[model samples]
Target: MHAGRRFTLTEILVWTRREILVLFGLSLVPTVLYAGLGWHWLGMPWVPIALVGTATAFVVGFKNNATYSRLWEARQVWGSIVNTSRSWAVFVRDWVGSAPPTGPGFLDARQQLIYRHVAWLTALRFQLRESRAWEHMHEPANVEYARNYRIAERETILAEELAPYLTPAEAAYVLGKKNRATHLLALQSQQLKELLDHDHLNNLLHLQLVPLLVNLYEQLGRCERLKNFPYPRQFATLNLLFVRLFAGLVPFGLLPEFEKLGAHFVWLTIPFSMLVAWIFLAMEKAGETAENPFEGGPNDVPITALSRNIEIDLRELLDELTIPAALQAENNILL
Candidate 1:
């Protein structure tokens, strides 16, 4: 979602200030220490230092590559969200356009479905980002503004301690279903069909709209995968430990060259060791952050902004007078 301009050095520092500081402590101190040792006691084997440095560069590169892979994959999922949203919009406009006046409440039904679809985009975005504070984004959040709104229903499997006080339910039934999204889809489609049967809409409109419902399901499946799956914690942890171990070994490895550079070699070893460690750790953190795009990290796609955009687009499509402000930006960063 970072567009218009690349981040400034200041902005990068602002976003990653804490992480950078931690990496400096973890990686820089060791490298500088060993660089000094290499200069003073093992100057003859610059060859081996160069090789280790080369291998360190490769490790950093691998980390960068892995982080980018997670980022790109997350973007791909969001891309599908955008396209699917547009698809639903097209169906909505068409569905509403096809109906005549007072035709079995076709107009209301389509609007309900469309507005709910807009909401679906919002909830899906929030759910992915773990920003769904239920009272704020759910309970009253109308996933559907029009007749065919598809809100995600929290499927009820059983009753809780205060379940009986809330509403009427056969507790003995032992299970309940509240599929917000799928239920909306089925409800709207069924309502649309009933209206169509009454000559509320033509075949083409219904046919076109039905497919979008299925598309919504597919997108839901994808989001579920993204929300639950994460990068292997062990691999990342091991690499970090391995990097630290190599840094610790550097001092001993350079003992033979300690004569010429004397104490000055410490300065050289410190920076070298730390620089590589920072790169590795920074990238490892990047992957961890990218692994869950829903967490609202800097690297995450702006799901909140995306939800706002969907709201905007739906409002525009409806030609409503009460369009709200566009998604806010942090100077340049959009949510």
Candidate 2:
């Protein structure tokens, strides 16, 4: 996500430059027709335009609010995953005994459970990154802007990311599964069962650990819900149509008002109309980008960084010396 306190002017301009240009062109066309060609008939009535603007404002506001809710929910799901991950680390470290019969296998079992969880996190993030037709990541503007920062899923292969967290056989097994994250969690459950059978984990400890796995499953399901289902297309489509309609007609309405001011003042219609249209267009763009929080946009939840933080914390719990450092944001954006 954008770690900076606010977006830079250059970033805002770059994001909205295409919309601004279109708005300017739309505004200029009507001003030129009305002033230069004396096509006074080109001006639209102010009352109808005002009504349309008011309606567009309401629709855009609803769309933005819905989109924000989706973004915030996605962030909360990941937050739960972070909290559960730490809990899993502590439980495996403290509850599972490192004693007799359990022997060396006990330590290996604990490490395996944590590492498999890391693999699950890796697989889930990669799955979330997979492109959906509704997502904006494939759009030219988003793709171009993405070049400014690293996208972990795009920069590395899924197998490579999971490799460090799983053995070759386990990684291959997960890769072969349709839902790798779910499969990894199942494997974790199986491992916990084995630990219980071997007396490495008691009945009460197994009960505690199983619920955490269930919580992870629920969290994964929550993430899947957001990823699979999009903001209602009917609402999104109508919102765009309304914004376009209002923006297109704004210049027509302004031309007549500016014409009454004076001859030279007629030129002011272009900038004023462009400004109004740009606001609506920018709002539409913001909602569109926010609708899909896992698309690796700068505004998206920093899932990769969050997963790394979990990994570092879990690995350090094992007192491993080679723990990777926490992820650092580049260009004031964490991905």
Candidate 3:
């Protein structure tokens, strides 16, 4: 989400301003009390302060490294998603072999299959995000639970994507649940089976499609990984506590050394606490948000936008034009 750029000053201030005020208020009272007790009583301790700073740095560094690992992993999985999508499109085009326009040939078959493929990607994206309602996702994703799925639409799309790719007798090999991609493929395989039954296709087409099934399985694994593998909660909670502790201690450490005799210079502790508190807290909050990249944060990827692009890519193969514009988020923090 941050890409190569660090956060701006404005972003930090806005995110941490409230906590800064609270830290300032909490520290001001102690600073004034300590000052009222005078320099004689308020003996400064630098050792503890140094230890706290060291601890703060260590924790920050460790947590940051772990958080970025998660971000990078999510990005890598999506990269595979992009690659597999292109591969699928290419496979469809080749498999269909350009049925004649008016003679139940390639183009018509390709059109049907491409739309279903695009729809599956869209559904899968929303399902990964948990963004849309369950029922709403069925048609687009093509993998609706039986109770949730409508039969007519599922059959239609299945027939379209597989029609050009599979032979009729091979299509009859369809079995089991009406999964969108699987159903289409099984039917296509049935067509191949039929061709084999009729001496049309040999075992070569079967061999070619086996790898495609393996790739689909890999994509499914990737989807499962993103949805399930969140950062450990205990680690995130501990780091959060550590950041707060660091923020709170900054004032006590500096108040004695920085205090001036003129006026109520003790107030410096408030701003000092505010400043350090803001920096550490903002960083901690940001790190937390980014670790779970799919849950809809300001800095999270625009999955919907990406899905639409996928849809458009698939449709362009058929010359359709109902596609939407690329929506860009301001400040590079896409939701």
Candidate 4:
């Protein structure tokens, strides 16, 4: 996500420059038709245009609010994942031990639980990154912007990421599954049961661990819900239609008002109309970008960085010397 205090004007202009150029070109069409061609009938009354613009504004506002809610909810889901993961680390470290004296396998058991949890995070993030039919990552602007930063899931194979945390056999098994994250959770449950069978965890400890696993699954389901579903296409399509209709009619309405100043001042309508059109387009684009928080956009949740942070935190809890450093934002974005 954007980690800076605010988006710079330069960044905003750069991101929307292409759209602005298109709007400018479109605005000039009717302005030239009205002025140079003496097509007085081409001018539209300001009242009808104002009504359309007002309606479009309200629709766009609603869409943006809904999209922001989805984005915020996705962030909260990942936040819960972070908290639950840290709790898992703490519980495994403190609660799993021999009854009287430490055994050779005691530390290994703790390490296994922690490592497996890491593998789960890796699988879930990769799963979230998998492209859905409605996602905008393949859109030309999004694809172009993606070049500015790296995305871990896109850069590497999921099996490769999971390899460090899982044994070869386990990784292979997970890779063979259709829903690797779900399968990984099942593996975690099985491991917990095995620990109980081996008397490494008592009934109370096992009960505590089970609830955490359930919370993880619930959080996973929440993430999947957001990833699988999209903002209603009907609302999105109608909002776009209204915005475009209003933008197209803007120059027609403005030309008459500006022409009242004088024939020479008629050209002023082009820039002003284009500015209004660009604003609507920018707002629509903002909502569109935020609709899918897991799509690896600059505005999306920083799941890759979050996963890495969880990895580092859990590994540090194990006091490992080779723990990787946390991810840092590049160009005011983290992914």
What do the candidate models score in CA lDDT, each in turn? Answer: 0.54, 0.90, 0.56, 0.89
Q: How well is each residue in 1-335 modelled by candidate 4, as lDDT tens digits?
A: 99989988877887888888888888889888889999999998999999999999999999999999999999999999999999999998899863321123224778877888999999999988999888888987778788878888888988788877777778888899988989888987887787788788888999999999999999999999999989999999999999999989999999999999999999999899989998999999999999999988999999999999999999999999998999999888898
Model 1: lDDT to the true structure: 0.54
- Model 3, span 28-56: residue lDDT tens: 76677677755535435657976876787
| Tens digits of per-residue lDDT for model 1, 1-335 | 44447757665455456655655565444444446334333323556655765676576567657757766776677678777777777667765544442223224655655665654554355346454331112211112111121111222222342132121322222123343345445555665787679877678877877787787788777767666665555655665665655555454444334325666554454445445445555555455555555554445567667767776777688777887677665545454
What would you estimate as the lDDT of candidate 4?
0.89
Given candidate 2, what's the lDDT at residue 224? Answer: 94
Per-prediction TM-score to the true structure, in the order listed: 0.67, 0.96, 0.70, 0.96
Best candidate according to TM-score: 2
The list of candidate 2 runs beyond 4 A from truth reads: 99-107
| Candidate with better TM-score, 1 vs 4 | 4
Ranking by TM-score: 2, 4, 3, 1
lDDT of predicted model 3: 0.56
Two-way TM-score contest, 1 vs 2, winner: 2
Clash count, candidate 4: 0
